[model samples]
Target: MKNLDYGVIGNCRTAALVSKEGSIDWLCLPDFDSPSVFTRLLDEEKGGSFAFLVSGEYVVTQTYLGNTNILSTRFEAPEGAFTVLDYMPRYRTSEKSHYLPPEVHRYLRVLYGKPKMRILYDPKMNYAGEEAVHTVFPNYIRTSSAVDAEDKIYLYSSVNFDVILSGEEFTLTDHQFFLLSYNQKLVAIDENRVLLDYERTKVYWLNWINRSREYRQYGDMVNRSMLVLKLMSYQHSGAMLAAVTTSLPESIGETRNWDYRFCWLRDASMSIDTLLHMKHQGTAERFIGFIKRILKSREDTFQIMYGIRGERELTEEILSHLAGYENSYPVRIGNAAYNQLQNDSLGYLMDVIYKYYLYFPGTLDEVEEIWEVVRNMVRMVLKSWRSPDQSIWEFRTRELNFVFSKVMSWVALDRASLIAELLHKDNYAELWRKEANGIKEEIHEKGWNEELQCFTQAYENTDHDSSLLLMQFYDFIDARDERYVKTVKAIKENLFHNGLMYRYKAEDDFGKPTSSFTICTFWLIEALFVIGETDQAREIFESMITYSNHVGLYSEDLDFETKRQLGNFPQAYSHLAFINTATLLSEEKKLSRFIRP
Candidate 1:
């Protein structure tokens, strides 16, 4: 069964998903947004992959090296036993620079008797739009797309190129290595250099993990989620990705699939906020810098998402030729939701900026520049808070005055007011506070459903939305308030199925969602915990943890009955929620902030 049983490895430049049986299934080359080099995860026959085929007698197990991103898959059989350590080299070269590269290093170490396996090396560049011609050389094998000469990858290996290309059986009696690079290597490619790179990369991850704050409970899982988030962060532009892959269907054979390679303002902001709570300060600063760079014009309207390098126009396209994941059709590349009027994004960004003001407190000029951003966000919020638009779910068909969007618009004003007070601008703070209070009063009057005794999905409807559980999370309402407590339980009753929670049960453009949104379950757990349902919350958390793939990683959604992972792999939103909920449960106490006196 082709499941999302995969472990991700990256160097912050690019990432690859390695399946449990040792196959490089999904990988984007050179950069995260670049055309995929391996796409077998989407199309089994047409999309290409690189794998190692072993006999049926072999028992293979995969795991990540403790406290690091290096993935190790061991194969044991009566004939022999061996292990493959897969990682992308990432380590500090100097105080101000890192040696991150767009490549992967696979180190094979013999555990005992000679292991017999066949190397299956097949790569389809440019999203498998064209065939790749492989030209084998003595030291390396160069594969280039049939159409574009510039689109190429170099594979340097210690084993014979004939054995790899021909998929012939090879005997492994000693340690060997395979280095796959996007750019041709200038230095000597040998086992010794790869081994050194492996060691340094391992050490770098260990040191990075050592800096994160530890918890009394679920600490290892939190660390792993943080590492996954770090992998999705594009170091070049400081833009955080929603996921590494695109168009993995939410439900098999459903049209709910959308590309998630680019960075969403809300998703990236929430991810940075979670990392900040884990004491990873660099991500917060870098993301804020990315935001500043992209919002260069104060008049520039905020889109929900942008390319990794801050490209504004993400034209959606469908790859008609390739088969989608699990035969799901319309494999997509660019996300069209970029232009949607998602009013909720500004709130998340402003929340992060508020935290940065309190914790990071950079130089005077930097502070002023960010203050300008805060003001611009306020301006946009004030202008559009009354208008109806797409909410956090990014519905493509119709626009609604989503209750969550209104709450977040209020959050934007509230946070901006706090930022103003922090800068000691009393008049500005007072003005923003008035606007925020008006938004909140409107939500209380219109967004809440008196008949249902809870908040609805949108002001005009009585449908329950999982996102409303976050009202208390953002400090919009007290957790113990009757309305919020009722809303949480109402959403749980309506959306929670079998152990996972759906974003909403209502029908949308693609009909009702069948798969559970992974993050909504986390939100439910936290809300339940806050509402004094500690036992149930803990039980649900444990169940949710068990649903994660073998490597403790989650995708965007999971099947309601089968519990199969779906949507984009290693979704940042899912992991961010995991870290936040785990940390909240670990502490058993909420961290209250008195941003407003």
Candidate 2:
């Protein structure tokens, strides 16, 4: 078996991770919220996969087409070279008929010089331990199995393909091609359908790319990140997943793993802000529509997360069958944290609404119903802001007065003031502003530790937190304030590591600390830029982008030594950070003369 360096290809509904050596290591079919069909990234044995590899040592380089999610990987071996193009056909307005098929599709093509390669198609049904029967055909192999009481199988190739049961292989000469597909139901795919899929997929991606408003200096990176953020989005619901695959492990040989494939309310709101910043109003509108649906459902208390279709019942479970990636073990599915009360979520939601009002002007009546929901949430924040709850890290340890949470609580009221003024409502604008100011004063006086010269992680302790870096970005503190400058310096000295950052160090009763979060590192980059450290910010941003996989994808955490992605692959938080920070940098370059100190 060859070690794989995978890049992702997707439509808005589902995605697949294709390796440089030609392997589909991780993919969730039907939709981003669906159960896995090929999950070797979690468990190598029973977890299914489809791969094609060259016979000898080879050099590999990959990149997505400009401003689109289509991935192209080029491999150069001693014998020859070839380019593998990968993508899923996205829905288009003109081709309404195409939408009738499965919401997702994957295509592979040999686009360049002839190179001899070996292709392998072995798909394990079930999570990681169950067995299925394979029925071989002249042009395809169908493996059928049961998952959670539902019968499911995938059609492996429709064009002169061969397969091996469990452990089989085949070698190929240069310039040859093949096709493989997975679905909830098995159906015969003809050559004409396959050819149309290829054309439709390309056209869909290119058209979507054209819709993006142009950005300078970092246009290429920004466009690619935008496409990635789009792919993670669920088209039917407009809810974006946190990541495509779950339980890749935060630290190798450690158990700090959790499923991250669901849609986080907090992440969804931030995604709206990112799309709006990129001037993609249509995407922003779609996300807002999803949020409205959640509001209309109106469960007495909202969940911190939900499935792509807004399904609320997410029970967590563990799979112990297949061997884990790098032997990480105990691969997991479904997120347990869905039930936790992360108080910051409501505030984040309000922030998106407030920003939308500013970015896209609209009448108060158009969104008044949504404001009623926010009104109820504000009352809840007032009742819960003083109490201890799970912090942003979702640490299993006891909750404390997390500084970031307090900042967002202040935001909840601050944005409420904007809504009140816009709608001419006299209910709580004065009270909300007063309460917001009081929270700011309290955070300034109690949340900072003078002895440490840093804004502490929580009100009662002196430990520095990477999250405090958001203070300036949130406008809770002025970028030029001496105290703000001091906090930035303190984080650099205490929480910084190898130009990256850790959230904070707090030993649980068991004396274990969580690994560094990649999102926090990107947060530092954004903070630096806002504080007018433009050159330093740009250097750090460039260095952080280098940590992505061969095809410009990121995970939740990093394996510092091996430089491998070590969490849920292609985390939405990481991509959102890229979108926000890159937009800020691009804006600064345009306004350098006015903002330069």
Candidate 3:
């Protein structure tokens, strides 16, 4: 009965997906990649969950605690109304220590007002494959799997209630507080400590949100986007994950599930662009550090993605034991895309560096210091630009010279030339500029379809590509180019349905897509603005955000037939694209208003 239409709460170290009915359906303890303690999101029964249900009929509403990652759910029942405040502890570090080690993060639930509740607490460790042992204490209960004693949890209550040892069930007659923790080692529960823990965690998140500078016009949307990005970020290594939970399908009943818990360099680079634009310079700097620290050792090479801690070699495998989400089979954990030859990574990475240099040229140490890695990346691009590999869409079919990839290849060299010029390497800069021009010329000749009067998906193909809209955002293509106008017209003619735009209409590994990608439409909005269709751009931009869920979040795709979100929850690409498109739209609207008089 539970679904992903839920609010997410996290302390950067870990996150919990709590459904509207007050159930913690998905949570990975200790870290993002850690074994899930509650994962009913993937499977209903065997995948354990923590739920506190009202005894009688109730109307449920859910939201976050005012600009913080703390989630709250209100249950208004016939008997009475009660609210549950849920959060993972994230108190600021003590001035005494330079770094704080992972403490026992308490998932505290404080009930306000009195409502008879039934507790269903089940802990299935390691995909329900490992057996965990529970020991009862006077005021608390501690649990640790027999296989991994190092990771333990303590469950304590603020008030005693009727407890059934069978299935860890409890019956509550009144409101009370409970703490589920892996960091605290104490046996007795403390009410004052629970209250302080909640306050400290709330304050920490608010402080983090307060760090962002002014976001004018659509500040609320920007705030929500920034917070969602922050919630998906891994605190320990500063690696930004593509999404919080993985294996959510891009299409229901299809084998499109992918684990996005690891850090995709492409996604991270795109995220940095958004964060820096939103005045979250600290996050941008940290991610830059994560990349420099991770990729510095490798010579003339990069990956599509890496584990949160910069781990290489993410072997693709199936978790046959666990039933997939919606019974969609073959739940995967590690991503196989890590092995693909995604040459676009170089372009995205260089784009991030170029952004950093442009924003804080005098202060960005990473841009200047990581030149060795930068030089090697340029060399990699020059070597691999002509070869066919997995492009950004990451199709399981054979690779082609995707026009989007070629456009980004042009981006790589263009940025490399600019960076080289900034660093005063005239010869190197000129060489990259010359190479960039060649790629541009090749794209003009081969990547474009003359008869169709627009850019195509790949060389020699006439498939309508939504990614063609992206060419306008980059310098490789001018927005006013007749080819650009024809590309938009071609997509509107072939790929659009109602108000939404599909990524592509051609059948590929997954057959024809049944939904419009949220990010691609955002690209369309940006292109509309660029081509002086400001009125239509604003309308589309405003309407597209309405597709997001109740908490202003989006998945990778939304079903074209039913208008349901169909991919990973809280997708970074969609949100980042939203921020970018919204900002541009707002700016254009202001300009239009100013010029009207």
Top candidate by TM-score: 1
Most lDDT-accurate candidate: 1
Order of quality (TM-score): 1, 3, 2
Q: Is candidate 1 or candidate 3 better by lDDT?
A: 1
Query: On residues 87-206, what C-alpha lDDT tens digit does candidate 1 reach at each position?
Result: 999999998799998899999999999889999888998898889999987778999999998889999999888888999997899988999999999999999899899999999999
List clash counts for every candidate, in order.
0, 0, 1
Better by TM-score, candidate 3 or 2: 3
Q: How many backbone clashes does candidate 3 have?
A: 1
lDDT of 2: 0.70
Q: Cα deviation of 400 in candidate 1 (Å)?
A: 1.3
Whole-model lDDT, candidate 3? 0.76
For model 2, where is the 10-residue window of minimal lDDT?
A: 588-597
RMSD of each: 1.1, 3.8, 3.8
> How do the residues 115-207 of candidate 3 rate in per-residue lDDT, one tens digit apiece?
565677777777665666778877677778879887677677764523523533343445467777656644345767767777887787788
